[model samples]
Target chain A: MKDGPDIARIASLVGDPARANMLTALMTGAALTASELALEGGVTLPTASSHLAKLIEGGLLTVAAQGRHRYYGLAGPQVASMLEAIMGVAAGVGPKRARPGPREPAMREARVCYDHLAGEHAVKMMDTFLARDILVRDGQEIRLGPNSHSYFTAVGIDVEKLGPSRRPVCRDCLDWSVRRSHLAGQLGAAILDKILTEKWARREKDSRVITFSPKGRQAFERAFLEV
Target chain B: MKDGPDIARIASLVGDPARANMLTALMTGAALTASELALEGGVTLPTASSHLAKLIEGGLLTVAAQGRHRYYGLAGPQVASMLEAIMGVAAGVGPKRARPGPREPAMREARVCYDHLAGEHAVKMMDTFLARDILVRDGQEIRLGPNSHSYFTAVGIDVEKLGPSRRPVCRDCLDWSVRRSHLAGQLGAAILDKILTEKWARREKDSRVITFSPKGRQAFERAFLEV
Candidate 1:
């Protein structure tokens, strides 16, 4: 007897290419202006504006007035997670559009998944963490190991000082390309922040790819890839 | 540099109300005919046929020849999983369309999610299973607990004889209504099959609601809820 949630409304909002691009741009965990998003969506400013308004109305995004300009971001992590889940299904339902673009290789290697890193390196890191007992499975949830606080401190993230957040501290997100688990949630976001702040990788312009510098790649390998 | 997966295409397909209705109807894990699907979608046969063509072309569904008619079903488990994920996001994004219908109460009480049971009863059963250690967490996957075979057998499901399939033996699907884990995968499908076959619950026609007879309800509680 239940008529279920109205998935079509949200689905159609994300279904539009221009809006999808705008939303994907925000998944970098960075706020962007309408013009920037318009450029990313490959649409005229007016069209982009209309799309943005719809997105806000759809509850998929939020707008903030920083000054004369307005900054837009995904309303919350749920939007990003929803987008990623759709991507996973799309990857499986490959046809002409599912073809990998020129940047696909780089994206497959390393990319930003919402607030966290996702790709080959990210999946590998998840596997290593599970293997080393740095992350433990707690029923339906994943938890950080009891003695893994030192590991986080060494990587410049203070677990206790993550402040307050409604989201879980440790979460496992499905990586589209790898079809495996990737680190997500509060700690996941912090780790991505650390990587960028440390100059280990730089997020590409208007793209999800995160290119690690040669030295950064080596350092990342040494830290997470090895014991 | 990566132009990520084209989620917009699939989203748009499901975004259409008629198309979405048709797809959701198929989520019962039953193979429905074109005419039946047309009725569910609330569209004319011609319109439904065109829509079905697009869905088939889009790779969201599959068709099989049976006698003189064709039966449609979700392409695989991934489609069902993706639909549930979307439902989860839509549930959180309650603006106006998220309002519960009269049947919402019934759906919330007991319903089918794709191939398995969902709603209050389903979530309760999952909690009890985990609490009693009938289900164990194996990293990101859920596994059956050792010595729990008797419990499943008593419920009339033989895990070992579930037949070979690409899908896992046990999977945890997110329950949109409860925002909790519910059993899915081969074992889950088997349990649902048992439920219907044993007359524990009768699925409501043209809806997701599964109404349990009074006698059946008591038996279910004693079997899964009682120690």
Candidate 2:
């Protein structure tokens, strides 16, 4: 038998409908209060607290106490990615839910997937990067190429100031909607941040949808296009 | 909130300790009898059957009746990949078990990941393919280049015979041990099959380990290396 970390423990933590909802909500990359999570999970605050405790203990989530208020978020990007992968498989193989979200198409066009861009627009950006040789892929690994710095700089992103970090600079995260790869890593986050700062897009309140303005869409396309 | 498939339903099926063990055991890509899974899960035969039924119902597994006996295995490659991704996250963030298996080193060197090869040797083969331009990586997608046909044909993989399938010719599966990409998909399965058929390596009984003999190791290296 293969010896590995106990996946059951983690899966069980995510197995509950209430907990799954909370985790999915947290994938928006926001630190939310218990009340917010409770609403998200369709559970009471006390019930949400208990579930949050288990997730925190299981390392699936982390809590920060600010004075009397406690805010919870995903433990890290790995947790987010795992949830995304779970959603990917669930969407593919599992039974359909009774009520589908009303914003399915908008969500699929652009959304926040744990602090990084995902969905169609993100996939397109990734494709453009590869087509322009700005990002080079070697097997499973992705690396920023020589042209990347100039390109990112041209788009008003401080490529040099990203600084050194323990996290990988570039990574490929599988997009659930498109069934393709999108950039996910420090660079991915930086790119999303740049877009938001430039007013190219804005995340919808209480939702994962990332809506872009007509002008912003044209600007984004022109900026990230292959030279 | 995102309205998608009910992830909790499928996850809870995998959440039970006994069921998790059985699923992990099935990760070897071998279809085993209920009695075998019972032993793997350290549960009673009836309990194992119940859990297997739930997994099958949840679409995480599938069962086939062979004569008077029933054999259980993962539903498909997607299910296997999902399990692998779960394991990857579990290994990274979850609490460590008290008793780590003694074969950890060997398991990490070369072991079966579902159906295809994984671990060190598999990562090396993927690297060689990229270095030789036999497999081209376009961002998150991998494509078999012009050089691929001749190279695979030289190695006795009837490239033309692989035929058209819904599955892609190449895929990059993230290796848990190496934290890198390894080959997967139809072509990956074919390479592993070729290695086994040519007596280059043999899978250890009741385990995922694929041990290559000294001579076989040399032959594998020479065969995969660029001219």
Candidate 3:
């Protein structure tokens, strides 16, 4: 990747209209092929390839070559952060008169991010644990507090078992939209997966929104003390 | 805000290359005029005017008239967030490559977020306070913990007198770079202002970067245990 004095290079890469469209498609966090992205961006295959090359060269994207096809994604968290920071400002104005319609209320209320729980419900659940002294904040790290181990057991989740997997049992995720902390680690992700597997929530098609089922509504209320 | 089926209208408004450039310039957080932003975006005055009008019409920008010139800025936090979200995807592949250099280090260290604090230093500062029981996070709200009020008093800020102003004494700002909480709100802004006023830190001209003076560094270390 060009490390310095590459502003012109980076700018020109994004200055293209076709490339910008493809990038937007990937923003949803789904992996797609060059052909798929080309169609999404309304560009020819060769043009998309060129754009993908430039993105990869800039360290803004990473490409995984699998057999006859190649998949491209943002390079890393830093790339994502850069885009997020820019969006935070860009979202403020310009063609903003047409506000995106109100998100599905259910998903906005409670949902998942990647594998973990997020949105308002997740924040509230974390709040309940902290208020009850089940979790403690320690220097950008979250630790189970007091009788957290027993508490998890009482709640029917085995916190200890989560450690064996690469998935984290507990992790802190910053909710970009709400600008608050939400649970992400292995434990948190497991809990969300559990909810889905048990048919508590269903992911909205073509959207990140998660719709809670009737049973999920009752179960979540009981588990997390929803009023 | 239309809050209607106008994704195409909104996209077209943002879709133009030159307009996107002007918006990106404002994305850095400074309010700029037609002439200044035109130069930044590499467009002519008439072109800039048209772009600005579209942006303003699209509700992505708001203008504050100052005599003959109009200064445009992002309307609010939501606008900023939307831009960020868009660019989150748009920046995937720029045409140019930036050579990694010394300048990158300073940017990664500390920067400004509109009127708030961001970056690693701010994130760590907030984390330390939370870990040491100096601050507490309650859902989306941030508050001083058990002895935090006394601690603030002992440190020399007159929280009681400042009450008439009704400004929040402390707040948790989510650092865009670190993806963690940082101190913000009235107190965070005040502290930054004080540091600059005392010549402990200085802003890089035309940039969000902050440079700490030797004396200011010592003061920060003594006061906040900042490294």
C-alpha lDDT values of all predictions: 0.82, 0.82, 0.63
Better of 1 and 3 by lDDT: 1
- The most accurate candidate by TM-score is 1
The lowest-lDDT stretch of 10 consecutive residues in candidate 2 chain A is A92-101
Higher-lDDT candidate of 2 and 3? 2
Q: Rank the candidates by DockQ, best first.
A: 1, 2, 3
**Per-residue alpha-carbon lDDT of candidate 3 for residues A12-123, written as tens digits (9 for 90 to 100):** 4443556655654454344568898787657789988888887777666788888998888766554544444433443434344344545635444765565567778787
Q: Please give, for residues B48-160, the per-residue lDDT of candidate 2 as tens digits.
A: 88888888878888888979998897887667667777787788777744455666778888887756888898988888998888999887678997689888888888867
Interface C-alpha RMSD, model 1:
2.3
Model 2 - which docking category? medium
Evaluate model 2: give its lDDT: 0.82
> Is 2 or 3 the stronger prediction by DockQ?
2
Error of 3 at A226 (Å): 7.7
Write out the backbone clash pairs for model 1.
none
Span of ten consecutive residues with least summed lDDT in model 1 chain A: A91-100
- In the range B111-166, model 1's lDDT, one tens digit per residue, is 88767888899889878888888888766578899746988887767888986864
Please provide, for model 2 over A1-227, each residue's C-alpha lDDT reduced to its tens digit, 9 standing for 90 to 100.
33556889989988999999999889899999999999999999899999999998888899999988999999988887777777777877767655666888898899999989999989998999998889998645799887888888877777677768888888888777787788998989988888899999999998888999999998888887545
Candidate rank order under lDDT: 2, 1, 3
Clashes per model (N, Cα, C within 3 A): 0, 0, 37
